[model samples]
Target: MNTLLAEPGTLTTSPIRTQQPTGPRIEVTGRMHDRFDEILTPEALAFLADLHQRFAGRRHDRLADRMRRRFEIGNGRDPKFRDDTASIRSDATWRVAGAGPGLEDRRVEITGPTDRKMTINALNSGAKVWLADQEDATSPTWANVLGGQISLFDAIRRQIDFTSPEGKAYTLTTGDMPTIVMRPRGWHLVEKHLTFIDSSGAAMAASGSLTDFGLYFFHNAQALIDSGRGPYFYLAKLESSEEARLWDDVFSFSEQHAGIAHGTIRATVLIETLPAAFEMEEILYELRDHCAGLNAGRWDYIFSIIKNYRGRGARFVLPDRSDVTMTVPFMRAYTELLVKTCHKRGAHAIGGMSAFIPNRRDPEVTARAIEKVSADKKREAGDGFDGTWVAHPDLIDAARAEFDAILGDRPNQVDRQRDDVEVTAAQLLDVHVGRAVTDAGLRDNVSIGVRYLESWLRGIGAAAIDNLMEDAATAEISRSQIWQWIHQDVRTDDGAPITRDRVERILSDLLSTVERFDGDRFDDAADVFREVALKEEFPTFLTVGAYSRFLVDLA
Candidate 1:
C-alpha cells in the first residue's frame, strides 16, 4: 500500500482501497506530498466523494440557471424580489438563527489568505474576526490549496507558527484570538487535482468549494467545537437564493454526517451580484437555520452589474470605478437594502472591505487613507451595519473605532432597525448616478488588471497596489469595466469613444510598463487579459481559463 502511493505532481490512475462503503472511487490527480496525504486520507476522500456524488448535478443545474438568467436580463428582463418568496419577506415573525458561537461580535474583521504567515498574523491581528480566505485572497495552486488546509488545521489546535527566512519568529499570542470564518472558493471553480469516478466509469473534477469546506470541516469542525468555536463560513459569489439553498443543504448533510448538531455551521452570504441584491430576503430565508448574516461585497456587485448589463446600452453604462462611491443612489440602495433585510431577519449586517494598507514611510498618505476608511466605516455603522471588513491589521483599529462608537458596550448593533430605509427595484438598478467615464480611468484599469493577472499567474492572489491591498475582486472589476466600456462604446470625459483598437493599444502600453517578478508569466497573463476583455462572449470568470492553462499540476 505504501509503495502504491503516488508522488507529488503525478496522478494515481487507480483508486486506493478504503473502509467506507461503495460509492464514487476517489483518486488523487495531482502530486501528493508535504503532508497532503494526511488531509487526503482515505477517510477524508470518502467524505468528499459522498458530497460530490450527492451535489454535483445540482451545482451544474444552478450554473446553467445563472446563464439563462443572464441571457434573460440582457434581453430586457428586470430583476425583482420573487413573488413566490414574497410571503417569506412579509412574514415578520420568522428570523434566522443568529450569531452562532465566536460570531456574536464581528466589529473589526480582517481578511487575508490562509498561508502560514497570514494565518498567524490574522489570528493575532487584534480584530474580532479573521476571515481566513481561500477564495479571492488565495491563488489555487496545488501547494496553496493543500498548504492552507494544513495551516488551518494547525491553527485550530494552537500548534501553528511561522519564521521568516531572515530568522524572525512569529507565534500566536496569549490572549483572545480573532474568531476564524473560512471563505471557500465560489461554486464555479473546480479542484482538478482531485477526481471522482462515478459508477458509470465517467470521471469529473471535484468542486473547489466542497474540497475546501469538506476538508476543513471534516478535520477541524469537532476540534473547533471543543475549543468553543463552531464551523463558521463566509459564502462568496452566490447569485441567487437557490445557490444559498444548495449551501444550506450541504451544511446540513455535512453536520449530520459528522455527528455534529444540525445548526452547527453558520454562514454569512456575500450579496455581491445584482440578482442576489434582489433576492437577499429569499437567500436568508432559505438558509435561515444556518444563516449568520449578509455582507455588502461592493466590488463584486459592481462587476456583476457590468457583466450582466454591458450590452443593455447607455442606461447601464457605468462611469469611472473610483467615482462609483457607495453614496451613489444605486449602491446606496443595495447596501441599505442588505442592512434592512439582515436586521429584519435577525442577522448581522456587515459592510464592505476597506482595502487600504497603511504605509509607514508616508505618514501623510497613511493619514488620508485612514480618514477615508474611517469615514466609510462610520457611514456603515450609522446606517445600521453591525460590523465591517478591513484588509490590513493597521486599519482594524480605525474600523473598530467607528463600529465601537456605535456599538458601545454591545457585541453588535443588530437591534438598530432601519425601517425608514425603503429601497425599490428601480432605485437599485439605477446606474446613471456616478460620474462619466474617463481615459485616465481606462488606463488605470488596464494597468491594474495586467499587474494583478501577472501576480495571480505567479501564485500570488493578493497584491498591494498603490497602497491598497487588492485581491481577485479588484482585478475582476477592472477587466469587467473595460469589457463593458468597449461593448457599449462608452465615451470618455474627453469625448473619445471606447473601441477594441483603443483598448488593445492601452493594454499594449500597460503590458510594456508591467515589470513582473515572475519572468515570462506576464506573456501568458497578457494573452488571458485580452481574451477575457476583448472577446465577444464574456467569460464567467477570468480565473477559470487561466487556472486550467497555468495553475494545473504538472509531473
Candidate 2:
C-alpha cells in the first residue's frame, strides 16, 4: 500500500494499485466468503450507492430544513443566528452518559497502543476506563505515518488481552481489560480502524464526526451497518437545537437503511462551545428522541469562549485555564443549568473532564489532588450530573466512587426549577436583569447570607477571603449561595429524611457569625436589596423576614 504522512498528525494511506481477488483465500475456503458477503449485503450496497448519489450533488438542504422546523425560534432567539444543522444518529447503543454511580471515581487513561508499559500500567491500575487514543494524545510525528495508525490499532487489539509486559499469558475477559474506546482521527480514519478491528479479533466502538452534516455520518453509519456492528457516534461541537434535530432525522434515515427500529444508533453530543450552551435546552428537547446524554467539552469550550472575546477586545474577560474553573457564580449557574436542563428533559447530564492526574512520583500531592477531584464530583452529583469523565486511567475508580456515593441506586431527583416550575419569558427577563444583578434580589440575599455564613461557619467575613484566585468580588457572592441554601427551608412535609429545620439551624449560626465580622457589609447588602425591591415594586422584605423567622426558630 502507498503511504504518505500529513501535518496535524494524520496518517494517509493510498488505495492499492491492483485489486485482490474477490473470493476468499484457499485457507478459509467457503467460510470466509460466507461471512464477508453476509456482512456486506446487496441492500447495504444499494444504500451506499443512494447515499453517494444524493450527497454527490450537495443534497443536505432538505435535512437542514427539517432540523430548523423542529427547533423553532421565538422572541428571545438570536436574530442573526442561521439555521445551521448537522446530522447525527439518535439510536443510542451504550447509555449516552454512564449510569450506576461512582462516575467521579472513574478515570480514563489514554495510552499509545504501542506503549506496552503504559497500557499495562493503566490496565493494572484501578481506573475504570481506558481509551486507547489514536487521536490527539499520540505524537504527531508517529501519527503522520500510515503504518503507525494501523500498527497501533493492531497492537491494542492484540495485546490488550495479555496479562503482563513480559508476555505472560493470562485469559483476559472484556471486563478485565479497561472499557475500550478508540478515539480515531476522523471519518477518513474509519476504513483503516474498522478494517483493523474486523481483522483484530476484538470489539470496539467508533467515535468522532462521520458526517459533518447528515451526509458524512450516514456514510459511516452505512459502513458500520453493513459490517453488522451496532451503530454508535460521538457528536462534536454541536451549537444549537437545530443541530440536535438534524441528528434525530439522521437516526430516522439510518433505521430505515438498516431495517432497524428507531433508537438503534445511540449518540452523545459534546457541548463545547458558548453557542452550544445557550442552545442546550433546545438541543436536548430536539434530540432526546435518540440522545445518550450531553458532555461538557471543557477545553474546546473555554478556548472558543476566550478566543471570541479576545477578537472583540479585552473588555470581555474569559478564564485561561480549565483548572482555573468557572467562577463560583458562573459555575453555579452553569452546573445548575446543566442539571436542570438535562433532568427536565429526562436525559443524563454528564460532567466535563478533570483532565489533570496527580504526578505519580509525588504520592502525597497526587493523593490530595485526587481527593479534591472526588469531592468535586460528589458535589456535581449533588447538583445533578449523573456521570463524569477523566483523561487519566488512575483516577477512574475514584471518580466512579464519588458519583456512586452521591447517587446511590435511586433514579435521579429532578430539580424543582426543572420539573415543577415553568419559566416564562417574563420570568427569564426579570431574573436576568432585575434579580441577578441588583442588591436585595436573589443575588443580594445570597451575597448577604454568604458573608453572614462565612463569619458563623468558617470564622471569616466574605470580604476577608478571596473567592476566586484573585477576583475578590466573587468571594462574597460565593458565601451568599452557600448561606442561601443553608438558611433556606427545604423540608418536605411528606416525611422526608431531612428537614428544613435542620438546614435553618445550621445556616443561622453561620450567618450570625458573619454579622459580627462585617456588620457594615450587611448595610450595603440591605441598601442594594432595598433599591431593587422598591424600584421593581417587588415583595422583597416579606421573603427575607420569613427566612429570618424560620432560620432563628430552627437554630
Candidate 1 per-residue lDDT over residues 358-443, each given as its tens digit: 89899987998899999999999999999999988889889989998998999998887888989999999988865878899998
What tens-digit string does per-residue lDDT give for candidate 2 at 1-555?
Answer: 322211112223334423322221101111122123322233333333333333322224433542353233211232222234222222223123322222222223333332344445555555544544333333222122123333333333443334465867543234344433333332212222121111223322211222122222333444434443334445554655665665566567667865676765655566765556656666765766566556665555544343232223222232112223533343445456666666655566667655446666678767876886687677766666766766455567777776667666644443323443332322221211111211222333344434433232221211222111111113222332222322332122333322334434433544465535544444443333333222223221122332232212110
Candidate 2 has an lDDT of 0.40
lDDT of each: 0.87, 0.40
Best by TM-score: 1
Model 2: worst 10 consecutive residues (lDDT sum) = 23-32
Q: What is the lDDT of residue 536 in candidate 2?
A: 28
Residue 249 displacement in candidate 2 (angstroms): 3.5
Q: Which window of ten consecutive residues has the lowest lDDT sum in model 1?
A: 2-11
Off by over 4 Å in 2: 1-208, 211-230, 319-323, 411-555
Error of 2 at 51 (Å): 5.0
